[model samples]
Target: MGGRLPMSGMEGFLAGLAHPVIGPDHLLFVLAIGALASTQAGGVWLPVVFVLTGLGGTLLHLAEMNLPLLEIFVSVSLVLAGWLLARRQTPGLAVLLGLGAIAGIFHGYAYAESIIGAESSPLGGYLVGLATIQLGIAVAVCQWCQFLRLSKAGVTEANGSGRSVENLLRYAGFTFFGAGLAFLSGALPSL
Candidate 1:
């Protein structure tokens, strides 16, 4: 069953690792976080803020805490994150991290749904998987953006490639924007 707990620690770990990767919305949002962090000072730690708050959110859910219109929050987070990525000028570290914090709560709450009723060992493994994967992805994305030399502004290099990493990132931003809208549309109908 979708709601059933994992039978073992390994299963829980796999499930947690797959959760964000399988969800396009979550995947895009995390990618944007990396892209966003790349342009800011001390930006690499942004994912740490996200992951810590995300763990907090999971704990809240496990405690049976209720967050109203959670899907809406999650969808809106994607929209906000996408908008940040799509913008030519970047915001300061505090602002971006603030957004990441809020988004993390919603995302983590959603993640908690998959691990409900899990044993302590499985739950530990799940948390580790989630943290490791999210952190790794964000760091990798930041490095990739740097490697591509993406400017603070969405500038396309004149290289004959005709497409630049900045353009690709901007395109990704638009994609996330569209995905958020689609998800938001579905979530709103339930309200």
Candidate 2:
């Protein structure tokens, strides 16, 4: 028999937490979003909007509205977001919020796939964990951005370790690009 084993309640919650972390695309998407949301104008609200809009995407998935080439889009989003962060582009609050929401939609839809058939309690816990994890990362990034004075515009002076941040973003960008290419290759068979 190839039947799957049923998970206990706690196991379900833990699995929920682990799901996003398990996928590189998912993790990068969230981290890039966190970096952008933390540093962009109206940073405080953009993350919130991202989370909420992502929830909408989850709803769409629950309704069985699957997006084709989701993996490709997700990987591309990671590349774009990482580029934005690496370049330290200071887009307006609206544009930042829009970016977050767009990325959130796809992420949320992907997130819901693992929790299908979950009970109410575990589902609730999963949603809470998802929000908590993303928000926590966003706040952490925001702290780094503020402390390094990375978010402020028109400052030619490199706040201590600015070079380090740029290097880190560069590495992240390369990784994102590599991952996106991997996804594209994986998807080739289907197309």
- Among the numbered candidates, top TM-score falls to 1
List model 1 lDDT by residue over 1-191, tens digit each: 26578878898888788888998778877887888888777899788899889999999999999999999999998888777777756789998889889889989999998899889988988998898899999989888787777453334555555666666777778877888999899899999
* Model 1: lowest-lDDT 10 consecutive positions: 150-159
Model 2: lDDT equals 0.69
Off by over 4 Å in 1: 1-3, 150-164
TM-score per candidate: 0.90, 0.78
RMSD of each predicted structure: 2.8, 4.2
The residue pairs in collision within model 1 are none
Q: What TM value does model 2 have?
A: 0.78
lDDT of 1 at 25: 75
lDDT of 2 by residue, 51-106 (tens): 78777877788788978877766767776776676665647888888888888898
